[model samples]
Target: MLSNLIRQGIKPTPLIVCAGGTSSRCAADGLWTVDLRARHRQLIINEEREEVEVGTGLTMAEVLQGLQPRGRSIPVGLSTIPGCGFVLTGGIGPLTRSQGLALDHIVGLCGVWGNGNIFDLSAPTNPASPGTASKNETHQQWKGLLGAAPFLAVVTAIRLRTQKLTPLVIWRSVCSVQQLEIAIEAAETWEHSASLQWAWNDNIELFITCCADDPAAMEAMQSLRTHLGYCPESSMAIVAGQHAQPAFGTMARAADPQERIHSEVISRLGPAWGQRLPSLMADLKELMNNRPHAGCQISAQQLGGASAQIPVSRTSFIHRNAIWKPWINATWMACDAKGQESALAWLMRANNLLSDYCPGVHLAQIHPHLSCHHQELNDAFKNWLPGLKHLKSHLDPYGLLPPL
Candidate 1:
């Protein structure tokens, strides 16, 4: 298929291979799109090893459902979107604080590059592997494709190491700006069993999840209550269930699928941003006072446990020191041109205001269509770009995929 396109002298949108079709990286003029959803839809589970080989087209929810009965789970995104693009770009999720990014669990990959050459990347000792390359050679290729596969290849399948399934205790609370700031500070120093996700949409809502009922979880909850001034009888409810139950389901229902919404996302990494939350919240409140749409929101996720312990050089993901992932997003109706412009303008201002606090960006929320895309990419990859660019040049000389 790629050879035919190349022979015909055609270059389509770089998003041709995206399984979720969620990125804004595609050409605005609507170039040809290559859909791979129909081709790769299989899931092969290795129960003994707690590993699953999945088609790139599969969503995180689907994978979770498949693994639920087997008492296994993989670190996945908060949304039930396609898993391939998520892992390829350094997947961040609710369990990131404990399990680390999803990319860290990848054991193997199979794909075709722009040159129409098929390659299987893994540890090389597995006999079922198709690549005959030496161990060192395969390892080099593995490092390159770990987080930058979108820029070099069209991945068809991935084998990921899964973890033992465990139930999670979730606590939700609504707090003021000051209370949220206090909670953010508390979450930064939380243990591996606890993680946090909070959102601000006029009101602040925090979701704290713990994998166990240990003393660490109890202390974390106590600290939150003390900081937020909430007592046991003060509407602070703790719900317990499987991690898969509320993690993605709540997010899935947040928006109406039938509505056509135009949105922009800006992600930033701040290692010590929690310390400046009070000032940041003040600035955000002022900027959001005249928001273009009611659906506009800001969210921050704590990320400093196992996710931060990993060295930056181990994978193409470079934001190892970051303790927080904060993003500002705004949405407007498709026909509301004025609303869209206003929302985008406000988002740009908000991003610029918070830029000094954050030094890196997440690829999952990156939009190449934005004017600051180049700068964002530079911030996200930092010193890692040179190696990634070399790999792209060697494997995709024609620039079949979008340049990062």
Candidate 2:
């Protein structure tokens, strides 16, 4: 099909590919739409390699459900609705501190680049595998695909390593910003088996989760929880593979059918930004007061642990030291131009606030809105754009997919 377009000296209109979810995608008007869900919904688990190969169409929910029977799970974002794009980008979840980002599990992929060339690439899982790739070109392509596949190719399938499923002990509370700051400080020093996440609406709702996979980690979780004080509102026990995170479900939800939401995700390396947390929260609280819409939200997920062990050169996710992933999500009623402008302006201001902490942007989703698109890309891909573009020139010279 792609060949026919090239043969006719034609190209798909600038397009959006729906791998499974629409939470972060923009409008489809005047653009070609490629929906992969209907035809690509297969899931297969290979016990020998302890991996599962998923069709790009599957949502994280479906993948987890499938893994449940096998007693295995993969680290993914907060909610399951993100679809495969979640992994193609860096999938940061509460378990990331212990398990690493979703992209880190990708062992192989099958894809077609922008220029209609098909290829299969794999990353070695152990020393016996080819890390010192006998074929240097293939090695480079493998690294490029793990985090930046959406920009460089149409990935049809992915093979991801899975972990033994475990139960998570979670607690929730509504706390003062100062308490939240203190919790953040303690979390930074906590064991990787635990993670802290919070979102602010009318109040600051705090959530801290620890995987009860081992005795030592459980001890650390208790120490941190005690230090953070009491939580009047706690949660029921949850087996990690049995359900999606109930706390940050909003992050994965789209607006009403008649509404639209836009998000600007930002990340900053930690150990350096720790001291400024108190002031940052205060600034954010002030900013939220003037929001044009009540639906806007500010949320953050802690990063570090196993994620920091990988070097920046390994994947397109260059913020190897990032210990905080915070985002400003702005939404408006459908067709409300004035409201849209206000919300976007508010997001820009929020980004500006984050920039002060030596921020690195995550191109979490495409920004078809030209005004912020180019600038955000520059920030997100600093020092890596030229190398990515060189690959694009060879693989997608026709600009068949998204451009940097």
Candidate 3:
């Protein structure tokens, strides 16, 4: 269908493989839209190689379900309902520090470029895969698609390097700002098997998870637990035989099913941002005190470990030095136009608050249809945007996809 549309001099408005984009953005002015959610829904698990080839339509939840019985799972973010679009940009969750971002786990991709061309960039390093990038052109496309696939092509499927499904020990506590700072500082030195994630709303909720069977990781988890003075009996949830999914459900806040949620995941992807994070806590506390509404809040997942070790040039997600992906979310009642305006205004204000602390951004959720899209595009890729634009021109010159 995409090839036919492109061949006929028609761009499909924007190829709709949602990677966490909002409904309003997709339905903007109700332009001629094409949703390929059903086109590629296959999930093939290569047990010997320990990788999962997931089709574009599969939700994170479905992926986890299939991997669960196999004793392997990939790192997926909160609310696992999103399609592969979740990973194309970046997907961060409690397992991030241990397993790395979901995108980092992606080894191969099969997609149709904007110009009606089909390309299958399989993982050469994987013994079960069939291709290697001996040529300069194919090499660049592999890197290009990892972090920018949604904007450059119609991705039909992806191959992910799945991780061992180990026991997870999770602890959550309502922390004061000072305790939160202490936890964040302590997290920086924790082992790769341990991670911390926190969110701020009516109260600041902090959760730490560890693959507790690892003695060293459990030790770090205990140390942080002791420092926070958490009541072990009440705060800990030990899913001793489960992977990430079960543990996360115990800690995740349930959104009211009725209200509309519009949010952006973001960060100043830069060096030593974690070291500077605590310094902003006092001011952030003040901002939370003055937030526009009860629905407006902030959350962040820790990043580093295996993720930071990879070279930035290997993918479009350039800010390898970033240790935390903190973002502000603003939500409102669906029918309240004035509330929507205020909520959005606060998000912009909150973004400006953290912009100077870092030199880059995370297009965590691609928002090519919004006002922040342009600013985020320029900043997210920084110097790399020019090269990405040149690549986009080659693969998607018809403006058939989102802006770079």
Candidate 4:
């Protein structure tokens, strides 16, 4: 692909081959199987320390399972089925409120750069060498890893910390849109008192998931449920390997059993911009003026426990303090190109609600509405540009790496 694109007068760039995409619905089609070895060293899995040195090609779910026996877990985005390890782009789940972003636990990486030279980046001991290896500094290094792409290197192996497993408290409710707004306001207020995770759709429905090590969390959940005035189906425990139910139950009979059409923008908010988010549904209400493009929704997963403590600069993922990582999505099962395009376009427009609020990284699905700056190879990453370029120059000065 690189040779052909270059022959057609396009620029050749470094490309990191990844395997096992977790977010099939949200990524460029296809996969690349890459080596998982750490240069000439043997891979390590320190279950005693709740950490593992893994191949970048492994799926998020795979990584979780790898640590499951140890009763340890990592914060990951919603879809864990995708094969590659691009969790830093945007990850949210039941464990997010406690554990932080998936990339937060990364402690080390070994990969081939554009120059074809394999390099390892761990936490830095000194501020000057931001690429050094250390336990806590891994998250900072991971943040630098994004956007630089294959220029820095193909991430072959990643070392990340894990956490102990805890119980999950999930609640489901169906309400009118007006009721949903009231529920959202109540949920947001309760977020401080209860530390809850919640989502809602344009159809005026809500789903809230809460987690804690104590019974107080349950009490808080009860308060929110009472305030919302809806009897929720309770005790929906969210554990690893089990499929999660849709935040809002079956939409239409025409909807695919697996295809849950809910809007992330309405229910879940991204890391940095949730508090004062300008609602997309509010805008759509004005634009369509009573017309519904099948409606959009927002859902959320809380990040808590060890996640809240992870530093922003620690990993490529910077959204550590975010209350909830909102997933702004719509579901459709159309296979025709035209249907695909329409669904994609609608999702893009819904996502654009955040364009002015926060910049996002591509993970489960590539953002088609991503601005030209975001699409530019370098803009994909911030702050780590120089190091990546230096690696590229050293590894592929001849520019043999594939272009974006």
Ranking by TM-score: 2, 3, 1, 4
Taken over the whole model, the C-alpha lDDT of each candidate is 0.73, 0.73, 0.73, 0.48
Q: How high is the lDDT of residue 177 in model 3? A: 83
Worst 10 residues of 3 by lDDT: 243-252
lDDT of 4: 0.48
Identify the runs in model 2 with alpha carbons over 4 angstroms from their true place.
1-12, 124-134, 240-244, 249-272
* Runs with alpha carbons beyond 4 Å of true place in candidate 4: 1-16, 23-44, 84-90, 125-143, 146-151, 187-205, 232-254, 257-281, 284-312, 319-321, 330-335, 359-364, 367-404
lDDT of 4 by residue, 72-155 (tens): 666554455654445534455655555555566666667654544455776454434434355334433344564234433456
| Strongest candidate by TM-score | 2
Candidate 2 lDDT, tens digit per residue, 162-254?
998888877666777777787777777776577888877666767767786666666766776677677676453555652655746332223
lDDT for 370 (candidate 3): 64
Q: How accurate is candidate 2 locally (lDDT)?
A: 0.73
Q: Which portions of model 3 show Cα errors greater than 4 Å? A: 19-26, 124-134, 230-234, 240-267, 273-275
Superposed on all Cα atoms, the candidates' RMSDs to the truth, in angstroms, are: 4.1, 3.3, 3.6, 6.4
lDDT of 1 by residue, 229-288 (tens): 753323333433343445422331345446688888888887876557778878877876
TM agreement with the true structure for every prediction: 0.88, 0.90, 0.89, 0.69
